[model samples]
Target: MTDSVYVHMAEYLANPGIIGLAQSPGDLVITEFMANPAAVLDSDGEYVEFYNNTGSAIDINGFTLRDDGTNSHTISN
Candidate 1:
């Protein structure tokens, strides 16, 4: 599954000229995100994990996580 995702992203990046949309490389990615937990209730179980895929550090202070257009949460360090 990971291989397929990489393949698709590679294809998308390679054909950006045809799509007329250029995408720059990103540093952070959501390695794990769970809205519900098996061992605990939702109130205490929802969590997200991010990985810095770049060499430099990343500050995600102003980043936002949104489930929909109206509902969102800001990430702060």
Candidate 2:
């Protein structure tokens, strides 16, 4: 969950401050990612999975997923 997220240019990541206690939605962590080599599109079987530690809803309306340094995607829904 150490992703560089911004909400209207404001850092929306859970800033657990000094003690390192995690905040609400930040508890949702990336659990797994799938990557496989396919005969056609190499990235056809790629996927990511996340798990929410807290039983609360999270609003990621404008969150962006940027990894790999070259490709990025902003969540719209």
C-alpha lDDT values of all predictions: 0.53, 0.52
**Tens-digit lDDT track for model 2 on 21-68?**
225555767677654446457776776676767666655555566664
* Residue pairs with clashing backbones, model 2: none
Candidate achieving the largest lDDT: 1
Q: Output the TM-score of candidate 2.
A: 0.55
Instruction: Give the range where candidate 2 is weakest over 10 consecutive residues by summed lDDT.
Output: 2-11
lDDT of 2 at 76: 71
Counted clashes in each candidate structure: 0, 0
Task: Give the Cα error of residue 25 in candidate 1, in Å.
Answer: 3.4
TM-scores, one per candidate: 0.55, 0.55
Off by over 4 Å in 2: 1-26, 35-44
lDDT of 2: 0.52
